[model samples]
Target: MKATTRKIRDADATKARILAAAKSEFARVGLGGARVDEIAERAQANKRMIYHYFGGKEDLFKVVLEEAYLDIRNAEQALALDHLSPREALETLVRFTWQYYLDNPEFITLVNSANLHRGRHLEGSERLRVASRRFVEMVRDILERGAGEGTFRTGVDPVQLNITIAAIGYYYLTNRFTGAVMFERDYMSEDALEQRLAFNIDTVMRLVLA
Candidate 1:
């Protein structure tokens, strides 16, 4: 029994290692450029083991995309914005979204890769869509609460609002190089990032606030 248990634990660990390695591989080169041999080497596992775990390169790519989406959705769920006042919840959501993008830029790259594939990989991910609904519902609830309290304008489209908040932060970081050159400023600098953070908060809040 002990030996069986140990074997199961080892298998789980190996699978996790493969997944971690695969995520990095896919993020760096995307699906078209990513190769299985390199992923196996990085995971310290054989190609046979990777195939046993995930079937093929395309299957592995789909799993990676699902996991990435699930991770972001799980983080948003963890915020439990419902417990806070509407205004505070919106602020927290904006800040969390900004920080998540900043800390995990790999996610941005992975998503862009998926888009490049015309969302073919993501279309196979029912789990991610289910996970995403929780966030959508949360945003809708927050908007309703804010409207009820007369703290925000009524008839706001939660989806559009959510997109706006994410876009404001995502665009700034993702396009920082171009923005910096065009505006002649250091967007990644400590002071500049802080300024951007303040700007994101102020601009989002003012847009929604009544």
Candidate 2:
């Protein structure tokens, strides 16, 4: 029994390692550029193990993206929206979303890469689509409630608002390569980034609440 339990634990650890490595590779190189051999090397596992656990490169990519989405969803879920006032809820959502992207920089890259390819790789994944819609619905509920309480403007389309908020956060992280060249400065500097976040939150609040 002990030996069987040990094997199960080892299997779980190996799967975790593979997922982590796959996420990094996909983020760096996108779905098209990511290589299974490199992911195998990074995970310290044989290439065959990746196929054994995750089927192939495409499957691994899907899993990695799903994991990234799940992380953001889980963080948003922990915001305790019911306990906070309408304005506070919006602020908390904005702050949490910003921090999530900042901490998980790889997520931004993975998403941007997928989007660049028109989400072809992710189009087949119904679970991912559902999860995404659920998050959108959560944001919509918050906005609707705020509007009802007069804390937010009426006729604000939640989907549009969510996309705008995402654009603000994602552009800051994903546009680093282009922004550096276009803006003539380091876009990743601490002070500048904080200012950008503040600007984003303020802009969102002004639009939705004022």
Candidate 3:
């Protein structure tokens, strides 16, 4: 039994390594540019083992994309926004979303790669759909609470609000280079980031607040 347990742990570790390597490769260069051999090398595993565990390059990419989405969703759930007051909850969510994008830029790249293929892999992910629904519900509840307290307008679509929250942060970071070139300033500077975060929170609050 001990030997069997050891074998399971080893298999899990190998799988985790492969996934970590693949995520980095895919995020760095996107799915079209990512290579299985390079991923194996980075993971310190044989190419055959990668295939044995994850089927092939495309399949592995799908798993990596799913995992990236799940990671953000799981983190958002952990924030427990429901426990906070409506205004505080909305502000906290906006701040969290911006920080999350900053901390996990790889997630943006992975999502871009998935979008390039028209979300072919994500279409089959029931887990993603369920998690997304839960997240939307959370936001909806927040909006309802705010409306009930007469601090926010009613009939705000949570989906659109969520999209706006993500887009404000995602677009800024994804285009930081061009923005810097065009604007002649460092969008990532300490002061610049703080200002951007403040602007994002204010934008979100104004959109929903009464």
lDDT of 2 by residue, 115-210 (tens): 787877677777777777877777778888888888888888878887888889887787888989998988888988888889988989998984
TM-score of every candidate: 0.97, 0.90, 0.99
Q: Candidate 3 has what TM-score?
A: 0.99
User: Deviation in angstroms for 86 in model 1?
Assistant: 0.4
Looking at model 2, residue 129 earns an lDDT score of: 73
lDDT of 1 by residue, 2-27 (tens): 99999999999989999999999999
As for TM-score, the candidate ahead, 2 or 3, is: 3
Go through the candidates in order and give each one's C-alpha lDDT. Answer: 0.91, 0.85, 0.95
Lowest-scoring 10 consecutive residues by lDDT in candidate 1? 124-133
TM-score computed on alpha carbons, candidate 1: 0.97
List the candidates ranked by lDDT, beginning with the highest: 3, 1, 2
Q: Each candidate: how many clashes?
A: 0, 0, 0
- Return the top candidate by lDDT: 3
What TM-score would you give candidate 2 relative to the actual structure?
A: 0.90
Stretches of candidate 2 above 4 Å error? none
Model 2 C-alpha lDDT versus the unseen true structure: 0.85
